[model samples]
Target chain A: MQSFALYPFAPPGDVAALRADLRAWLAEHQPHDDVVKRANCWASFDPDFSRALGAAGYVGMTLPAIYGGGDRHPLERYVVIEELLAAGAPVGAHWIADRQTGPLILRYGSEEQRERYLPGIAKGELYACIGLSEPGAGSDLAAVRTSARETAEGWRINGQKIWTTGAHFSHIMLALVRTEGGSERNAGLSQLLIDLDTPGITIRPIIDMAGNHDFNEVFFDDALVPHGALVGTRGQGWKQVTAELGLERSGPERYLSSHALLIALIDAAGADPEPAIAGLIGKLTAEMWTLRQLSMSTAAKLAAGEDPMVEASVVKELGNAFEQDMPRRVRAIVDCAWDDDADLARLLRALLIASPSFSLRGGTREVIRGIIARGLGLR
Target chain B: MSDARDMLCDTARAVLRGADDIAPVEEVGFALLLVAEGQGGVGGDWGDANAVLHIAGMLAPDIPVADVILSGLGDVSMPHRAAATVSLMAGAMGQALALSIDHVNTRQQFGRPLGKFQAVQQSLAVMACEVAAVDAAAAAMAARLDASGFDADAAVFEIAAAKLRANRAVGVVTSIAHQVHGAIGFTEEYDLRRVTIPLMRWRGEHGNDARWAQALGRQVASFGGRGLWENLTARAG
Candidate 1:
């Protein structure tokens, strides 16, 4: 009789054009000469590359033009980030600031704060890191003991923050702390924009098994900031961080972490792959395609200003599982000898070491499932 | 969820309710839900029939609802049994998931429920992921079918992906569903085997994971990388 559709049949024309522009820019500017560095992709920290990207106006696209952003829709930014990620571009330097922090500030920052940080962030000069996970409280973010006491100057922050990515190099820390003390889990929390160089703050790198010093444990012992440091409202950190996480968990980066390895697997397999190997490739492609659609749909929701907490969690949970399983599955298909010089072998080796943290970084597998369970009314 | 689609779904559910046998379902017009108008039946599209397929799957009815519905679309050469097999496996997985959850909570080992064990929970968690992925894929396929008719060449990738992913999921879901049930699931008398055996048999029908995967792989290869991304993100307009 009659058919109907819920999802879009084709991407907006502007999005397709943006995709083409990004593809061309990446081809001309990306340093494809260094295989290992390129293999790092989003995790590779190259300030110069980020600066060039900013100059090209690919960063801070979703913010208002009044604050030096492109003032485009979130879907536009989604397109750019997806291209950068799939190509394994070195976007780590501005990844956090551009992806979520700038948007967070745009949404909640005071006029002065926006004028102070948005321009620099949009220009890709400023960098920021999330300050949610603590040594005592990671998945249980409400258990944050980092206290932000009222001071005549502004706020004095004291506590330890762990798993803070880009903390050492980043200029700002969106620290979540206990502003009003009580036994309540999520209340009494506030987000403060802490300058990393502020006094009494110490950042020591916690090198991962891959020997990458990307994340750190910061000791915020009475770190001081001026009155303009508070983001949104006091006692609203939990709410703000929850929104920020929706941005974090529902992007193309969630699933493209192991993309380099997939490409390498293809090259190693050659045109004539074994039937079993082809089958594995097919499985990976199908799952990735499905997750990609789900993620893009979530981006559409976010662009439409809908809070898709449940759908975002689905992306992270399923995406991370597929990413983490890539190395194992590729190993099954190819003869991974773990030689450092061979490209395929080296990529597989790096993925093997790095894959364990895929689930642990955004949210642990157990914690993500709990969120999904709650969403599904199973909990 | 239009008025017409909603009514058709209600009628289909009512007609197929408790239809452990296919004869009664055919006696009603439920079998012609996908038949086009003027074809001696009420006309409906793949999108409308998708709801019926999903509910039939969830209810785990033995009637060949998906098959009969597919046979009505005279132009397409799709095997009716293949469509039925997909829904059957999906429904069987749902039943297995529900049954295994109950088994884990009730069956005890070492004076505690099996679900209390960390290992068991982790396994169940993985199984849950598979089920979720399959569910999402099915819904996505339905939406895609609604937007672009199933006859369009563009729909092949999604159709292949959905069937491929669903077939792949059944293997993992059935394994874990059985693992958690232990010997009880292996026995013929237990209700779990009934669902598991059909799932095992359906896993090979209408082209299994490997078959659909090959089709998907050829399409991706022909399109190359850039076209591949276009195919993936084109749904966000």
Candidate 2:
């Protein structure tokens, strides 16, 4: 059994200055949108905001400067994103590209691919979405049946991807597709960076119960991209995608998605709140503080070039539970209605609806727990 | 961990193991662990104290190891006690997790080890997460205390948050540890209760969930919504 140790989260350079600069930038540039938009701010798409943020050099802080990046440290990027999330900045547009795609492209993409995509990603004009979850493969991602067959022109893709967030607006998609005829499970899968505007690709909106079109069902009907689109190595999509998820799961967004609600709760409850409200605030704050510690440690571990797979899973599991339970717990303690128009009430209702997807997205609670169990030397 | 702290923990584990009382613990000179080297003491910091107390928490939960170590300070405040209790609870929770993992891996049900079952794995995973959270809380609290030179007032937010988080984890850690262990875990000879019982007691010691929650909540409320974030980031980085 591996005991959890706190990795030293010492970012290089001036982190306080980095935070102050970002906060100041957000104050001037961040939209004063509806408070509900700030609750799950990462999913709130504001292309102009993302472009301005990218122009300000916060988007691709870790990429090399030649690719229009800041050449900053990974922890510096971590500080920037956390500050963005905590302040509920709308960062959905360039989020995927900046967080994973840019790094992945820089690491594995060919020089041509990097030259083509990295600058746009850094500029926040181009967007990307992951194509992992298929209809038959949600938690069981190894069961992905989306096929990409090699041909004279390129790799022709034919499959359907459900629950693809931002597919409609994303310029490209880094998709996992089965490349071998008979290979099964996690083997023989290859990742292809496909242009979303290909002739055969069609993206249809999947309106969620919240009446939000944040997700879509994307159909790749013989969508062909050039051979240079293959990222890293063939038959290594499983490994690459797993690494990408580690980047996805342990981020500040996992916990700070519902930060707007907490802020509203605190502002609504005056300095001297009722005991029950105060107790609830304390409980939430403690969990949030502890979560931040765990998350930063995991980030530091990642920055130190170690695979913190289990630690990342631990953060995702606990963070999902915390964010999901906040609305229900608040509703139980505070007097709020489903139809209330106050910020707290509106934020509460929106999050209560959004909370169900918290664990379902990224990875389900059971899947994350299984990963932790595997790390525990069990199964 | 530094070599000196590793040696301190090694000494703590060796001296405190199987000892029924605090005599062996005191004999190890743990009382002077936090004292200055100029004063003929170890001159160890709170990080060292946290590490040693973690070992003592695993090896001798019934002993007053925290008291012995804090005796170097002459007077210990409630927040300091709370910080020490968080470390102890972290160690105990870790032990409970280890014991449960061992039991499930060995105890067979149907045709395989209990750990092979999805249900059992999920339960243990939850327990592991809670243990990790408490461990993280304790470690972060220790860092804050060391940063503030052991002034509990300066590190009150971390102490309160850590203690409250540890308190919140007791039920989850204890219940899952026993649930995965089956009937054998209930026996006095079984090692699970050695840590679980201490964790339960420590949850109410120093400060319970309500006490720390109200303190931390009111303190954060005073910081206001946005100020809380500013204050937290400023305190750490």
Candidate 3:
């Protein structure tokens, strides 16, 4: 009775204007003609597109103005990202940085580091990647063996990070490394902003099942960085990383990756949505609604300046299913394929290719579930 | 917002927890459920009644107090039942019954926990689906009650729908829970014995699923042919 429409995170006042401005902006600037015409052909190394986003001030609309950001609410950022991703914008270049890294740096980065990184990130001129998952670490940060040896110059990093998205095209990596070998598994871990082109770092692409050039493995052999590169503090990387994850995992992107396809699918059905079709839609809509409320509650928890990791995981775990299931559900509903012109055919195709990454990229569904179970007082 | 309802629930929960060690309670459970104050376990109607049902669920995996309350009211009180309580007066979380069943440690024929069986899990999951329906219906109704006064017309449909959906779970989830527990599930000492009996008895008490459905359908046809989905919302609002 309240509203069937879920995930209306917009505050009542600015929402209408925001939606109008966004729709107009999106219509005027469709994805690069090539992207719209075909799907799965995205190249993550599109700097020109990134720069255009910077000029439009879409990259970092929520950070403070002094840092070259619009200093808007995260809710606005949430809606903007949903619209961009739904429209299939070539945001791969700035995706991680804007979504996770920028926020990480803003919230926990040292003052000088923020001054250095935030403006560049807001401009979309700089790129960033997370160097968290190690070769043997699995999802357990406690297992990380990446060591950062302190040098007079700063820190020398030596370890390999795997499953890092956009690692091949990124300019910098905010890496997590163990600075001390004490029994404290979480202690002694530190975050270093390692330059990808540094002397001892190598990046190699690891093609996924979809043959996407999105993810890569990185070898950090004594990579050098000044002391200022240490985000937060040494031995505090574990805390900083966990906090950053709360931002990374929660938000609209969790459920909206398939929204464009869902909308198009519904529009194709016309006025009387078939009962069988409506059942699927109703089920999907309900699941999405639950995840959105959980996510919004998480965001509300964050706005109150709490960790919200457990809540984030619950949302992400559920959210990923809703996102990943969309393409398969569309296919199952009526044997629809990537080439159907009923409406936004190319967009549908993009979802087919991109849906697999929905769970793996942000955090694997298994990992999210682990967080959720632990949150629910499980082992 | 009512203090009486809040206290009634607290008492119900306390009674349910302490009920585990007690012998199978078969002494006109409804009469005991509505003694007005201090006559037996609980002492109020709908709110107290269903709160006992929900808490009873945790202690005794198969208890159908939720359904019993709904149908008892539906059969005896008639119109008031339609206006007042939905099976969803029992506040719920997502897939609550399913998730709770996961913790039931009863062993099956295969020498494993019943939860270890896919068939049993699926059955329980259907119960979870019903619980989710209740979650949706209850959330909508609660939000309405909070924002404005409840409208009787809208309340009838929501209560009927919620009862129709969630009331079914008493038979479904509790039955499976008992099946998993075997003969012990029905015994006086086994803790959750009354669950199935109450759920089954309650289901057909207030005219069964058919009766409510017919009324709902007739009401739909009464309003100028096309279903008044929006008019229903106006009452809800």
The per-model lDDT (C-alpha) reads 0.77, 0.92, 0.60
TM-score of predicted structure 1, chain A = 0.95
Query: Rank by lDDT, descending?
Result: 2, 1, 3
Interface RMSD of each: 5.5, 0.7, 9.5
Best-first order by TM-score: 2, 1, 3
Candidate 1's displacement at residue B228, Å, is 4.1
Q: Report the lDDT tens digits of candidate 1 across residue range B55-159.
A: 676564455777667767656544334444555566667777878778887899999988777677667666766776666566666666656755535566677
- Model 1's chain B yields a TM-score of 0.85
User: Candidate 2 chain B: minimum summed lDDT over ten consecutive residues — where?
Assistant: B19-28
What does candidate 3's lDDT look like per residue over A1-379, in tens digits?
Answer: 1011112233335654675576687677655544332232223456777777787888888789999997888766765665565555667678778878888888778899888888888988888888888878866767898888888998888889998888887888988889986646787898888778889999999988666667789998888888888887778888888888888887766775555565555555544555555555444543544444456556766766667776666566656766778777767776555566655566666667777777776677666655543443333
**Predicted candidate 2 versus true structure: per-residue lDDT over A1-379, tens digit per residue:** 4586579999999888999898889899999999999989999999999999999999988989998989999999999999999998999999999999898999889999999999999998999999999999999999999999999999999999999999989999999999988999999998899999888999999999899999999998888889998999999999999989989888999888899999999999989999999999999999999999999999999999888889999999999999999999999999867799999999999999989999999999999999999999998
Query: Which residue runs of candidate 3 sit more than 4 Å off their true CA positions?
Result: A1-13, A32-57, A83-90, A181-184, A336-356, B1-237
Clashes of 1: 2
Against the true structure, what is every candidate's RMSD? Answer: 4.1, 0.9, 8.4
Model 2 regions more than 4 Å off: none
Which prediction has more favorable TM-score, 1 or 3? Answer: 1
Compared to the true structure, candidate 3 yields what TM-score?
Answer: 0.69
List, residue by residue over B75-161, the lDDT tens digit for candidate 3: 344533432334322233222343345444445466766565555544443344334344444444334333332333435554555
